[model samples]
Target: MKIAFYGSSLLSSYWNGAATYYRGILKQLAARGHEICFYEPDAFDRQQHRDIDPPDWARVVVYDATPEALTKVMDEAADADVVVKASGVGVFDAELLDGVMRRAAPHALRIFWDVDAAATLDEMRADPDHPVRAALPGLDMVLTYGGGDPVVDAYCGMGARRCIPVYNALDPDSHLPVAPDPRFACDLAFLGNRLPDREARVEEYFLKAAALLPDRSFLIGGNGWESKAMPANVRHRGHVYTAEHNAFNCTPLAVLNVARDSMAQIGFSPATRVFEAAGAAACLITDAWEGIEMFLTPDKEVLVARDGQDVADHLSTLTADRARTIGEAARARVLREHSYALRGAQVDAILRDAAAARAADLPEMERA
Candidate 1:
């Protein structure tokens, strides 16, 4: 099957969370003999700040997103078996969606892939006049990276024909544990960008824990955090690239996860780092979330922290042997159920089913 995707920067992940998810899922899909054409507008200085290049496996078509270029691709997109319009293109999402819908054949499946389903749904509900709301019913399928149940229900209730949650998955080969560098090795580490809504949780879980362990070293990575104040023992490394993630994960005694406000509110929405850290066999200390146990068995596979005290206690008490055991168990679970290959296979099946359904519904003259 041939699939076309219009999303943020397909080949760039710098300061972009959705790009990482796309790269992992699409790369795995390509490896499984599916053809994918990623249509990304040459905007946002992505070329200057690219973190990951398009792998040899997939075809990436970069367009200017100008009127002429968009018109040229409209016909091509209409011919694809599936065309996906993911949220957060940030450049020409509205224009691209309009053009694709205008030119698409009745049988071409249109998907709205929402990486930030909670935020999008909240925005739409608050203001029905939002541009994307009008496009929802036109989509054949609504897929989300997170917001396990609420997101799907909201979209379906709003008139989407089908809604599915395709959660983030770990790429075992890319994220497995590796030799930790001394510079990166730390007693604890947290990697995520600073967003206003998530700052309080970060303080309660990560900063407070680091403060409690003044003698132990801690590292914080990700962009938008360079100006944030940190404790003396806490090291801030701004924006570690995808390639450096495995090393960072392997080196940490335990990696902390702090979900954004939207994800925390929606529940059951695990970030990419959770799967990546687990895949690298790094002990995970995550903030208490409502549906975390559904994804990772809390006490058995992961350590749940409700506040600074809980985080500090987890760090102070767990023996190195016990920590390693927990990490190994988490890694095993992720490999068994949350690998990108598994996600790719699931998506492949969905696409096949959607295509078959479209074919069956077509009139006799259009069936050819």
Candidate 2:
């Protein structure tokens, strides 16, 4: 099958959390003999700070965010077997959704893959006239990064024909345990772009934890956090590159997963960092969220924290051997069940099922 995907930058992880997920899934899909083409807008300064070049497996087409450029992208996608317009494209998202829904060939299966399903659904439910909500009935399928059952049920209730969760997974080949570097070594570490939606949780879970454990070292990574005044024990490394993730994860005694507000409310939605940290054999500590057990068992495969005090308690008492045990268990679980290969296979099955269902509908509709 020929697939055309439109989303945020695939070459840059610079403030783009979906970059790793996209690269992993698409690479596996291409390896399975599906032709893949990615369309990304040249905004977001992603082009300027690219972490990787276009992969040999797929063509990455960069275009402007102007109307003409969007029309051209839609035209390019018209002939594909499956055309995907991912959520959080960060460039005229509503317009792109509308254009793809209107312009893709009827035979082409159109998908609205929500990388941030919780936030997208929240907006759609709050506003009756949202473009994505309006386009729900026309979409062939809806895929999400998180928000398990609640998201699927909500989209289906809102007139979507089909909705599926494509939760984030680990790419073991790229995110496995590495030699810990002293530069990144810390008692606790949290790596994420400082976004408005997630800043509060970062403060509560990461910064506050640091403050409480002033005796222990903490590392903060990613962009937009250079100016934030954190605890004396917390060292900020603004914009850690994608190349250094494995080392960073391995170096930390325990890495923290801070759920963004919407994701926390929706539950079951683990961010990309969760898998990455686990894959690198980093003991994981996370804020309380619903359905976390679906991914990792609390206090066994991972640790749960309700507040800074919980984090401080965990860090203060967890022995290095115990931390290593938890990290190893988490890594085993991810390698067994959450690899990109599993997700690629799921994508293949979902597309085939959708196409088959659509074909089955044609005969019945013709008779009617």
Candidate 3:
């Protein structure tokens, strides 16, 4: 199947979380012999700042979202078997959504794949100016990256024809265990951008854990955290690249997972890091979240840390043998069931079903 994706940034993940999600899914889909054309706006500055280029597997078409450029690309989108409008394209995404719907051929399937479903829904409910509102019903299907049942039910209730959660998956080939570097090796590590909503949780869980283990080395890697004060034992290495993630994961005794407010509130939504860490056979200590058991079995695969004390307790007590055991179980589970190939297969089935149902609804011209 030929698929066209309209997402935030196909080539850059600097400040774009959604880009990582797109890369994981699209690469897997490409591996399955599906032809993919990714459409991203030419956000030159953002691209330069991030310094990432599109992968070899995808044919990336960069265009201006200006009226003239959009007018030209509309027909190309119409020719695709499936045209997906992903969340967070930055500017005028709602306009892009409208243009795609208006231009798509009658047989083409239109999907609204929400990378940030919880935040999108929250904004939609609170504000009248939410752009996706009018386009929701026209969408043939709605797919989300993170939200659990509540998100799917809410979209369906709001007149969506169908809603599915295609959560994050690991690319085992790209994210497996590797030799650890002494510089990166630490007693505990956390890697995530410093977002306002997650900062408090970081303090409560990460900082508190560091405080508890003053003698133990803790490493933090991510952007937007350059100026944040840290204890002597806590080392901050800003923004580890995607290529370096495996090494980073392998070095950590236990990797901590922190969810943003929206994800925490929505529940059951695992971030890409969770899958990446687990795939790399890194012991995971995640903030206590509802529905976590559905993804990674607690006690067996992951450790749940509720607060500062819980985090400290885990760090101070969980032995290396236990950590390795947990990491191994998590890795086994992900390799067996949660690889990106598995996710691509699931998405392929969903698209096929949607197309079949649409065809069934239409009457033959000869009969008419």
lDDT of each: 0.84, 0.89, 0.84
For model 3 the TM-score comes to 0.93
Winning candidate number (TM-score): 2
Q: TM-score for every candidate vs. truth?
A: 0.94, 0.96, 0.93
Ranking by TM-score: 2, 1, 3
Better of 2 and 3 by TM-score: 2
Q: Report the lDDT tens digits of candidate 2 across residue range 281-360.
A: 89999999999998899999999999888998999999899999999999999999999999999988888888777667
Candidate 1, 1-368: lDDT as tens digits: 78888787778777677776898899888887778888877776677777767778778877785878877766678777788888888776777777787677777888889898888899889988766688887888888997877888999988789999999988887788899877688899999878887898998899988888899889999877778888999888887877888889888788899998888888989999899999999899998878887679987899998898899999998778888898899999999889888898888888888889889999978866
Cα-based lDDT at residue 283, candidate 3: 94
lDDT of 3: 0.84
Write model 3 residue lDDT over 204-322, tens digit each, in one string: 88988898889888999888778998888999998777778889998878999998888898897899989999999999999988889878998899999889789888888888899
Candidate 2's C-alpha runs over 4 A off are 362-368
